[model samples]
Target: MAVLGAVGGLLAALGLLAFGLYCCYVRYIHAKYDHIPGAPRESFIFGHLPILWRMLRKQEFMHDLFLQWAEKYGPVVRLNAFHRVSLMIVSPEGVKEFLMSPQYSKDPLVYGRVFSIFGERFVGNGLVTVCNHEHWHRQRKIMDPAFNRNYLIGLMETFNEKAEELMTKLEEKADGKTEFSMLTMMSRVTMDIIAKVAFGLELNALSDDQMPLPRAVTVALEGVTKTRIPFIRYMPWKQKLIKEVKESVRLLRRVGKECLDQRREDIRNGKEVTLDILTQILKGDALEETRDDENILDNFVTFFVAGHETTANQLSFTVMALGQHPEILERLQAEVDDVLGAKRDIDYEDLGKLTYLSQVLKESLRLYPPVLGTVRWLEKEHVINGVRIPGNTMLVLSTYIMGRMERYFKAPLTFNPDRFSKDAPKPYYCYFPFSLGPRSCIGQVFAQMEAKVVMAKLLQRFEFQLVPGQSFKLVDAGTIRPLDGVMCKLKPRSCAGSCQA
Candidate 1:
């Protein structure tokens, strides 16, 4: 009996020793990014996980932390979340290799997290979140005609009407002493515009603050961003957030089903089809290559969220930037006055002519892009900046960090619209607010058009002032929006109704 017990003890000791050796190999030897320089992890097990959680919870500014790491460790820095190792690749060559090819697909496991938030299919299999290259290609092709110039040109009528409604709403608020959230106003208008232009649904977000669709979108996106945290779904305290998000998802999907069904019924009734995104969605369904009801619903939520959210944030940031720099604001307003001249109906031709307005928009996107970065799943090894990167690793490309780097832009922190002027050389890979290459945002044209019309009309009507004590800090809740909602007061510009400024 004593000899048998001794033998069992010896075997247990050997097993623990083997497990220890394996952990050492994974952490110190076999780890893919072990060679790269990075800030030391806060915990061997947690690996900066707690730091990220604290920062996110506190609503602290964290983008600059990544930039700081980049400055210290160079562009291709390593970061860890628990045992998982990911590379933050800011090198232009790295971006070109990873993002330019269909070979490196979107990190499925990473984007897949967005598919179902709190047990609800939020984005589902939409164009932005889908990882399958072939599927995304087919979907992109089918949706391309919807954003064509002619189709978008017709959208100007809707844009003009919705933007005019926003202006009227703001005119009442521009008392020069009453402070209000510019972002909220922008959200309402863009939400209304996207609903009208995309699905012919009247969200009525502009006039009604308590609208069900807008609130649902807000809650649904909250679900998306919150569920991203590690082990968040398991926490007892997160039940409220999870339940709210799931309900929001249900609301959005339910609304989508009704809208799609109505559109199909209209088509069956031999009704004249309108030149809107709903028509394009039906066209895609007609194609033999792609016809899935859930996929169509995925796009409905995608268009609603992606269509309105980013543009609203961009306009809000632009307003904040203009408010801070009166000279820049004056110059932009002057240019708007020169081109638009109080024209309520901003045409597609006029959009191109508002060159300075375009510059300001570009500059705003550079400083505060709606999307900070994207992740790519690499299946093969590649070298970036003379460093060998291992295969089967997650690669993070951050425009937020790159845009702020001095190596890419001179006075990277300054708000300079001239940097985007026609004569100035365009930023190659370093500037990708709308992203670049084949997987770039399909709604780029539509978004920019919507931004221009709203911005042009706003500048044409009112001169805005920033309210005191408002933080210019940014917050990342799925998409980046101003932390303070861009608190502002406004007074009418000289050209309120006429062509003179």
Candidate 2:
């Protein structure tokens, strides 16, 4: 009994020692080296997790929290979460350095899993996810032709057609109704645009039954966003989620293959192939020649997934914003009416004349960029803003926060389209709706053209007003969307004459 008691005593002593050592280790990590600036450290074990969680749940605006941190801790702030050290850079100068610097690369851990689920070959080091210097350069060179001015001009008819269909559908839905979810209508329209542009197929998803292809693709995308959470991919629930994602990916792959096969058949038969993005990609001998069938399919999937979701969110928000501010909407209506002026279709040439419409879209993007933030990992140890950051540190730049900074804009919170006017003062790095630099969004032009086309047609045909007492709160899902839905009343605007709300 005495021996056992002594052993227990020794074990207790050892436990106490270990506990003391752990506390010391934590203190060491939490201890601010003069080299590291700005971020307040919490208890070593929890680090910044609690602060982040609280801010995430309670703060309606996350950008505000980051901005506050920047104000308190300087432009660069250090945070530790999930045993990973992170640096948040708020200054435009810092952002420019990182985005432009070749040293910074897409964090593989974050994007690798995304690529894995989407299938490795289809993404084939595509522009959105790839990091390798040589690979990205090659991919960018090959993909550049698809976004040329001539091709975009060619796509104008399709954009107008889709927009007309959208307007007509909304008008029909608002026949007796005071308000409907214009947000949903816009989502469906953008999805249809992406389908037609990328695949040479007009899904017409706005009016049609939910197609299996888009539905599966959306599900897979949702899975990827959730799986990005640390260790969530390993959980049983997440494993099942991943399983569903894999199944959805397989379905999408099959659909993509079918589409490609059809295109190939048309090519072989000497039928005039559509001048859509997919056709252009297939015809381009540079990348497609070296890429396999699966790689090509991955690229298509990537394009569809990235292209649709971001634009859909932007379009939805733009409509919601215009609806909330009737004056802006009224002005937009007048502009569209004057520009199109009873034209059955808005041709490519007319787009240049619709400068006001472009300004509204630009302002909306500035207010709420489709991508709130992007993460990039440091490939080498680097100093940012006089702080030493070790290699592999996760660096985050919140475009949402950056867009709202007073340093970047005057009256940052207000929704003013005039800021982007021809005579208005421009600030460097102030607007990055599609991001800036070589790694910027490849489909930006396509997205803008589609939004303008849709918005113009809707303004020409219908007038929208925000529903009273309806909260249009921004919910951060894959993209920012209304927490409930964007419930708005629509009254058709007759082109023959102006009508009051």
**Highest TM-score model number:** 1
Per-residue CA lDDT of model 2 for 393-456, tens digit only, reads 7788777777777777888878889988899887566467676777888889888888877777
Kindly report which residue stretches of model 2 are placed more than 4 angstroms away from their true locations once superposed.
1-35, 53-64, 117-124, 176-178, 228-244, 283-291, 381-388, 494-501
Residue 70 lDDT (model 1): 88
Cα-based TM-score, every candidate: 0.94, 0.86
lDDT of 1 by residue, 1-501 (tens): 999999999999999998788677558633667788889888776686777888888888687898999878877888887557888988888888877888888988888887888778888889899999998998888888888888899999999999999988998988888899999999999999999989998877888877887778778877777875778889999888888888888888899899999999999999987867777877888885656888888889999899999999999999999999999988887788888775778888999898999999999999999999898998788888998888888998988889899999999999999999999988888888877778889999899999999999998889899999987999887889898899999898765647662
lDDT of 1: 0.86
> How good is model 1 by TM-score?
0.94
